[model samples]
Target: MFKPSAEQIIKVMQGKGYSVYDTPAVDWNLNIVGIRANDPEPGTFNDTLAVFQRLQGAWNICYYQITTDPSLHYLTHPVNSSGTAILKEGQYKGAYQLDIHNRGLDSGHLALCQRLKPVTVYRDSNRDNKLNLLEGKTQTGMFNINIHRTCEDYIQRQRFSAGCQVFAEQRQFAEFIRACQASEKAFGNKFTYTLLHERDFQ
Candidate 1:
């Protein structure tokens, strides 16, 4: 019953005063931006109040980072900040949603606690309490999970939706983090966000 969508997480991040923004596919003036907590040791990498404030560097506002840490149990961001928001454009105005997996991590695993949506079920024609064969939806080949979701929760939701009694419990953050790190490295300069000003000419 406890399910959250990627959009909800974005909204939560913005409410915390972290500053969320979209890179703007082409016209950034109307793009939406959202800020998130920085990687494990951001303080050692930057000279800001990162320890006191868990956020990506102001200079890196355009970039979003999610990492895997062996010491953490559930995903955590800055408690001080309820969240943040930035003006931009996308699927909606004021708020929007995007699969966290596509947020960019380069891995198929995600942190244990972000947010997720429970799968929907279809009613069977038989009118029986049990799900019918055609009404069942199975996620067999699905693997990529590096997004805003907990693997255990995701699998359970999937199984519940598919009417299957099987579900995966427990997962390794390292494996998911490794994939994200690899993807992070591949991004290189792309990891950097750009601050562009709108031209009055437009």
Candidate 2:
């Protein structure tokens, strides 16, 4: 058991904006670590694990409680069963959110320092085994994905008779039209595709 000195505590309080209320003299957990005051600012912080690299004789501290009761056989571990709260680095209390992927080669998916509220998805509808876009639940449900995509190999046999695949932007545009069901009313399959709508903005 390490005892915190009064001078060290006062120095920490004065140097950091944190007040005595925020820094109650509490026993720190072994996992919590400290950093040196001279170290550069950290670039990446893990949200899943609430650990900080601080300088000083810095120590590990857990949010969970370790009782002083000698009768207990083990340290009282905090049960975060709900797993609802995601402790992000930098911020003391909030989960980190991010965009799924990048649209280009140069710029990667960057995380905004902003925090977002956690959302829950559930399939509650009258339809049976059909996707309803209006249901509000995204395609995030574990069981909601198409099972055919998971098969190791397709049962049907096929032959490659076609030539090299070309970059057909027109065909790609037509595919998008069928996907959106916007051109189902039109009655022309052989006709060449054309730009349907053009926006003024670049």
List all candidate RMSDs to the true structure: 19.0, 28.0
> 75-155, model 2: which lDDT tens digit per residue?
112122221111111111122222212236332222211233322222223222221224343322112110001011211
- In candidate 2, position 171 carries an lDDT of 42
Model 1 residue 200 lDDT score: 10
For each candidate, how many residue pairs have backbone atoms clashing (under 3 Å)? 27, 8
Full-model lDDT, candidate 1: 0.24
- Per-candidate TM-scores read 0.21, 0.16
lDDT of each: 0.24, 0.20
Q: List the residue pairs that clash in candidate 2.
A: 29-61, 32-59, 32-60, 32-61, 34-54, 35-54, 35-55, 36-55
Kindly report which residue stretches of model 1 are placed more than 4 angstroms away from their true locations once superposed.
Answer: 21-171, 187-202
How high a TM-score does candidate 2 get?
A: 0.16
Off by over 4 Å in 2: 21-80, 84-202
Lowest lDDT block of 10, candidate 2: 158-167
